[model samples]
Target: MLIFTSVTWLDLCLASAAVYLVKQLSGKKNPAPYPPGPPGWPLVGNIADIPHNKAWLTLAKWGKKYGDILHVKVPGRHIIVLNSVKAAMELLDKKSSIYSDRPVFAMGGELVGWKDGLAFLSYGDRFRYYRKNIHRVIGSRTAVNVYEPSEEIEVRRFLKRVFAQPEQLDAHIRHTAGAIILRISYGYEVKDNNDPFVDLVGRAMHQFSQANDPSAFMVNIMPWLANVPEWFPGAGFKSLAREWRQTLKETVDAPYKFAKDQIGAGIAPMSYISNLLKGRTLSAEEDHMVKWSALSLYAGGADTTVSTIYSIFLAMTLYPDVQKKAQAEIDAVVGTDRLPSFADRDSLPYIEALVKESLRWNVVAPTGIVHCVSEDDIYDGYYIPKGSMIMPNIWSMLNDPQTYANPSQFNPERFLDNDGRGPEREPRTISFGFGRRICPGMSTHRSIHLADASIWISAVMSLAVFDISKIVENGVEQTPEVDFSSGLVRRTLSHPEPFKCSIKPRSAKAIELIQQDVNY
Candidate 1:
């Protein structure tokens, strides 16, 4: 091959520039009709307008100004926000295949080494592989029941901790959730709050949430900045990413290695990891996937479960009437002689409604793992381009006045019909997400998962065992505030601010029942 002259190199550069200009210019010609949104400024588009905190609320307000489905453009990218159930169903659910992909989460995924996670994976055969494995392992009806005893054991342990040290309820919940997830995913037991595994995983998760926050990393917006040296000015995020990567790697590998060691020693408990490892001889890549997926299960389940459980407790404290009503229903069915179990779910209609309402009242995953479009599509005369981010405003949908009357008020009766048989319209608190990207592991100790009812059993049992009320201080009752955090996952924003709650035994029989259940 002959070396190119300066003139030749210049000509080549001109040709490339010409093609790029043409491509950019062509896109502007006959541009598809994008959905109505707040008018954005030149160059930056809506990037400046996007609210870092409480984005869902701002999007909902935008929905009222601009129709139910609205669009906002950041430089070189597009975002579609769906604020109504009808609109979300029409696109995210009805046309799922084309709208089920995930956006490129540069900061949260690649930089932090979370790309192996199923939640952040793009739509493809690999995504399908992870999804298939997850569903096979935990999403199936049979698989869910297989893990019920582990869930039940962890939950009873949590109840005992709450009964013993209710002041440390938060730590107890965090410990219980971590322990249950570790046991189910890797056959690993979390010994205490200071367990190395819990600490490592917890740090990774905390960093993950921070990295995912829109304002946390600038490299997410300008990806090229990631290539810059870590020591460069304004490149501190890269250093942070490096630290996160180390923690995350340990989070993904440590428990998996422990499980493998147990299996090799012939003392491994049956678990998602142990079973999968024993079933087949996977390639190196497949093995990596399994490890990451197992870690994801632990990471995904723990904090979300904590949030929902906290919300349940907050709701009970705030609305004693609802608590009394659910307790009455539980007592009527299960009797005060024993703690309510999954067997009583069929009879406790009010408790079921209470569960649904808690999910709907203050959703956990508000925007719910934003979906991306795989191809260009048009809905109601508006164009949604391929690769556009789709945010289903679950918070808005949950609080829709049309679907839920007095939605802000904590009311379980909304789930019941006039006859009070079952749910009139199931709460679309799809906090787990939607379409194929939906969270396969949705079960928690206080909420029902798609396939598992063990956690639901725990929630009812807690309700049956304790009467949560405002703490009586000197002669006055101080009610805990129903304040919530504004993050990707909604949580009781209290920063260990000792919320006053009098967690009293419903009766002597109830305490006896709790002891009996705890012993089992």
Candidate 2:
């Protein structure tokens, strides 16, 4: 032992350096060229190039320079942004077997345990099981149609909440969304004030956004830091991750327990979980999938309709003429005697187009779900390496000037005024997002089929009753800017930065209808 080490410290350092160099050199030898992007620095590799907030805008601008497929490298990861629908569809949709896997986020996915949810599940049997469980419940248009009556009833409650507290429009929207998802996912109805389930979802979603923020945790930036033990110096993130993980687990478990209790008493309503658990003895695997599959509906898809519902109010407030047009269409088709239901959905073309516009205006999951490639391949002559994160920039694709006329304008007519060109591209194919909820990661689309009925009903009923006008303060009309979260930090959903609009009933009849008690 004493005769052992001939190597000095410098020699050991040099040996490690040589090994790193060899690996780097081998990795650099790509089979084909990488898609064009702003040149990254030698060591940092585009660390300064990407914006933390509103990164999609910067990526879209890069698309103009780099073509549809743009590549950017960070310290230890390669990222590819699919800026066109064709490219996204070709890679993430068509060749999905390789492109559908997920890259685990250090904070949300792994440490906080969101990886157990469908949104972050890797492309494998668990992922398929989660998808299978969800599909049987709300996969198709017809399947989602089963929820139509509940949708109408809850939107009607939303109307009552809005009519009662117009100033708290955002809260009411979140409340209604939570109410609907709870009833559908578990058969448990939410309490109007301080509902524990609703609060749990809100906390979980807030943590989800916090996890997306690079500043919230250093581990998000230097993922290797995740390996540091809890007792290590300045490893406070471990404690925080543990706290957040408990919240996520409660979010998954608490509601699930409620659903099971209801089933045991034989008083459970037909719901995603109830249907899965009723009169059947599920294996341990089936039981695990059922709980998370229910969460996929709650913590995942809960905000799906919340974001689009805001689109309706914002659209109406900014463009009163468009609101008037939509109201007139609803009035003409459904009349004012009663609230509009899904039965009237087919007859109200303008209201239907309004749903499309709302989705298009503020992309629900703007940056899109990030997909991981399992193997190396060349796409359109560019080398797409394995483990590259493929983010379909839904914002870029939806807002492309060529695909959308007046891309910035909030006009529902874009879908209607296609000049016989088949009503433009359907926003649903893109708007529901190419993958699952919270922070975007590789997964299947939560899909427009779930949000469609809610958005349309909310829009139709809101317009039919309430006139959403610009808020007036001190006798001066104030226009709410089209903004979400002040662009100060990163965000997962495009929730509007707090804004005010004057929401008032259109008539005495409207007031009466809004005040009317909604039946289950």
Candidate 3:
């Protein structure tokens, strides 16, 4: 080692002083304090502390240590997680103009071409145009009414599949949800369970979810890695993205092209696409928006419904009394000769309670697609910088003991008041989401037509037709361990697991009604 003189030592001290001054100056713009959070390391911040599994629960735990509005930084990014319904609504709803934008999802949005989707689009003129057009087709409750015949036919098919192969309940649910969305979006019939469109679309979404996992790829944090050549060493993510991009292209293009061809040939069915095509001539840009917006409908619809219905199955297995109560209510209103329809929903109060409870108990999207702050602002006396990711901890809000007494228990009675007629509380307020960014399909408005979500309709139909009970092996009934997936969206993680349950037709009349399928 070389010896340093007083002159060299003085130079080093001056350099260190200059760096400190620069750091202080950089923080002056947003000198307001960040929301309370766990201690973080220098430079890396709380990167390692970011939970990889069930992050929504982890964030809630952090919220207790920090405050309701917890702040954490990951490298150059800022993340604000709202742990309570109050905070979520204040920021995501009351201040939606600034909080409705989405963060840049490099893997899911950019590389896979999902940025074109309305769900992932940035806040701008294009976003508004896409949203407006999507609403025109699927915005109203009356619009859903137009599809009730098809929905009923599909539900009947679902009932038949369940009756035949109850062991494949998950597959049947997925198929029904997929078929309904496919038919509604493009008038495409899902040919059996192995339709190529279903498979391809499933693969594309699987890849998107994989990429969506915060830890799945580093390129999400360091977007520059997306630019690396496919052949570059350790650049396999690029190839993965390309493969998924191709699948996504085919998923959006195949059905859309067919819909266009049918429309041109004058044999078009009354689908969302056909309805859109019949009206006014669309410019190239408008056409592009419609194509991708329709795809967003498919992306948003099926998986959440399938996950919740699976939760309902699990709930029925665990809570037999709840199942019995719902069945009793359904039987009293709908009778055994006919299956339940949308009209029967209001009449069966217990079934409605069960549906609401299913959503609140095991939320499909624990932390909904995170919103981004479009400008710097202060919330609860803490500074939230522009472009910060705002995560609404839906799980915490739904599970909070203060909100729902005995929150861990799966009790539908929480929603029923003394009369057991009108609801004391509404879970949909927390389940679908908050503010302007709320799920379009789940929102309610009396001014518009009575549009209902497919999930809600499917849940009522399933409960109406089948009697769910625990699976017995070797003379012992087994309770399924509630092992849900830790993905951004919750689902049963693994297949061929021990979550066995049996579903049977409640009566011969029910089976007969299901078999007598009506043509749409």
Best by lDDT: 2
Best by TM-score: 2
Which segments of model 3 are wrong by more than 4 Å? 1-29, 419-424, 444-452, 487-498
Off by over 4 Å in 1: 1-26, 419-422, 442-455, 487-498, 516-520
What ranges in model 2 sit over 4 Å off?
Answer: 1-22, 25-28, 212-215, 417-421, 435-448, 485-489
Q: Estimate each model's TM-score.
A: 0.89, 0.92, 0.90
Which TM-score value belongs to model 2?
0.92
- Model 1 clashing-pair count: 0
For candidate 1, report its TM-score.
0.89
List all candidate RMSDs to the true structure.
6.7, 5.7, 6.5
lDDT (C-alpha) at residue 261 in model 3: 91
Better of 1 and 2 by lDDT: 2
Prediction 3 global C-alpha lDDT: 0.76
* Model 3 Cα lDDT, one tens digit per residue, 360-446: 887778888889999999987899999999988888898888778887788988888756455545778877777767776543542
